[model samples]
Target: MAEYSLLIVEDESTLRRLLEYRLGKEYNVRTAENGVEALALLDEEIPDLIISDVMMPKMDGFALQTAVQEREDTKAIPFIFLTAKADEESRKKGQMTGVDDYITKPFDIDRLISRVNRLLERTKIFQTQLDAKIGQDFSQKLTPKTMPVVSGYTTHFYNVPKGHGGGDIFDWTETRPGTYFITIGDVMGKGLQAKFYAFSFFGYIRSTIHTMLGATDSPAALVAGVNQALVNDSTMEETFASLLLLRWEPEHNTITYANAGHCRPILVSERGAEIVTYSDIVLGLTPNSEFKDTSISMKPGSALVVYTDGVSEQVGKSDEMLGEEGIIKVVQNAYGHAEPIDAMVQGILDESKHPEFDDDVLIFWLERLTSMDRQTPRWFSPFRDVAEGS
Candidate 1:
């Protein structure tokens, strides 16, 4: 688990030091003399919990809390007020401001610590629940597990769980005889909301793909339709998605794919493995978007890997990131090995295990160039975000 950082914002230097010393026993604590100093600290790094005095020189605790609530990044951090005034108006004002907890002057050390710890724990629990919801929403609406006829080349997926549910999703459907439409997407955000956005984007892609099958049967048109649909949806205005829509035309022995705000697909051939980075705004975040399609002819032994940021973001135990270069190195090392794509993914994941995940991870491997009349991707329901778009 990541260490919780507590920020103390009291004007008195002596009280700040005493509180920092006391809280440092349990949490990583930082002290600031006033709201101005506290804001400066916040600009540097966000603390998990903030303990501020109600009265101060430049920025008071009330003003700080209000500012925090107004900002998107800081609004979620828990806030607690420390006030010498114990009047009804003060208490009511603090409560109305959504103060997680309050401490009166001459507070018992043990009592203050206990309250802070409880609030911190509660904040953690809320974050966990939110993340779980995102995963559930994605799985419910658009998981590949739910599909009947799998699309594209056949490859087993490795189990690489993100501590929180992530925004990565991949699905497929057949457009014609010996031709399959595959879609992969990553939604912006963390936890369930990310998953929710993924599902919404997946649904739009599925419906649009189906419609395209009856219309032009062009990969570019299909991508354009999907992008327009997502752009038109008001619910997804704040949320954006990166997508790669692949169409396998076996008759031509070629695969054509269009990208929208998604990472480029990689082709692992006998010669070498290279990333293909052709992408155009993650859908919904922009309008009147123009997307481009790329074509690649596959050899018999060739394979395609579509992955989320998680695969590239594998963190080591020492807080070191296993970046894209590391991922490419791992992939290069696995090449020509007897291991299947599943094993390759698992090996990468095994090499990248940490105590916790910074974000959700997903790896989708597509094998073979020929047709496999297998099941496609399935649907998962969206978690209703009560906070917004409710």
Candidate 2:
């Protein structure tokens, strides 16, 4: 019994009043005298559906529909036309103008209500399917954003899209008891197109992990397998991906990981922080690339900040980029913070100075916050505070 908002845009007061009276009981309805009034109402608050008269002063129904279609924000809203003529030409024109439903003059109240319900239900179903497609099962999709909870770790992910799409992929899923596979990758260049490359990469990771259930589930092997698959993919010949793959074993309290031409992740713990790096070429660009594995003990009260170049290479006002050292400073400055991950990112952004980011930024982590029992050496306490007291 959710109350959906409906907008009625008719110049005639009688019909408008009738619709308000009829639909008001079941829906949160608003009335507009003409297309201009409808546009004004749209500016104030977007209704779920728009019901507009075909003929009105200032702006006609066609003009209003065209304007709505032009504006990015309002273009997708479901629209209906209320016309006096029930001719075939008018119906065809309404369809051409992308009208979702139509109601002719002398229409029955029941017919109008039924059409309204059908359109709203159809739109709801479409939206549900779209959401599901964006984040379907067996995957942690990162289109809009993704934050997942896995036992034994505190996790957070932040993604700032550069445009319609820039190539940044992040996925993490538990494989078996106390084991997980996480990946963060950036496809070369920006502006999302095929997206097939990124999509294929995720598929390969999951399949490779499952295939290696009893054999190998290490980061190096998984990344190497992905590289081979990408090399075999003809569609990705013109592009390459820089990826960091990680495998966490909670039982062993260890992380075995590898990099494919990606920035090293910061391992922050009681010993302060150290960069975990490995030598490997960018995936797909080179043939027969071998990525070596590096394993690190998951210290009690430790966190790992895994990210792409967008974060580590954030440009500042001085034209100096906040590189690896700068990120480390941000982390140090964010120490003892209630939300250390967010504080650390804000510190980095503050250092960058610009109100907008030039590239999509992602700051991700797998963490266990600090405890008094595990304290770093007093000498290692202060290295750099990128944005302290800001």
Candidate maximizing TM-score? 1
**Can you give the lDDT of residue 285 in candidate 2?**
79
Write the residue-wise lDDT of candidate 2 on 325-348 in tens digits.
987777766655668778887787
lDDT of model 1 at residue 280? 76
Q: For model 1, what is the alpha-carbon lDDT of residue 238?
A: 70
Cα lDDT tens digits, model 1, 1-390, are 669999999998888899999999889998888888888999999999999999999999999999999889999888889999999899999999998888889789889888888888898888888767656655645656633233344554543445365677777776667787777777877666676677777777788877667767777788788778877877877777777888877556588888886766677766777887676756776667887778888766677777777666667655567766666656666655555554556566566555444566666665553332233323222443443446
Every candidate's lDDT? 0.74, 0.77
TM-score of each: 0.62, 0.57
The whole-model C-alpha lDDT of candidate 2 against the native structure comes to 0.77
Please name the candidate that would achieve the greatest lDDT relative to the true structure.
2
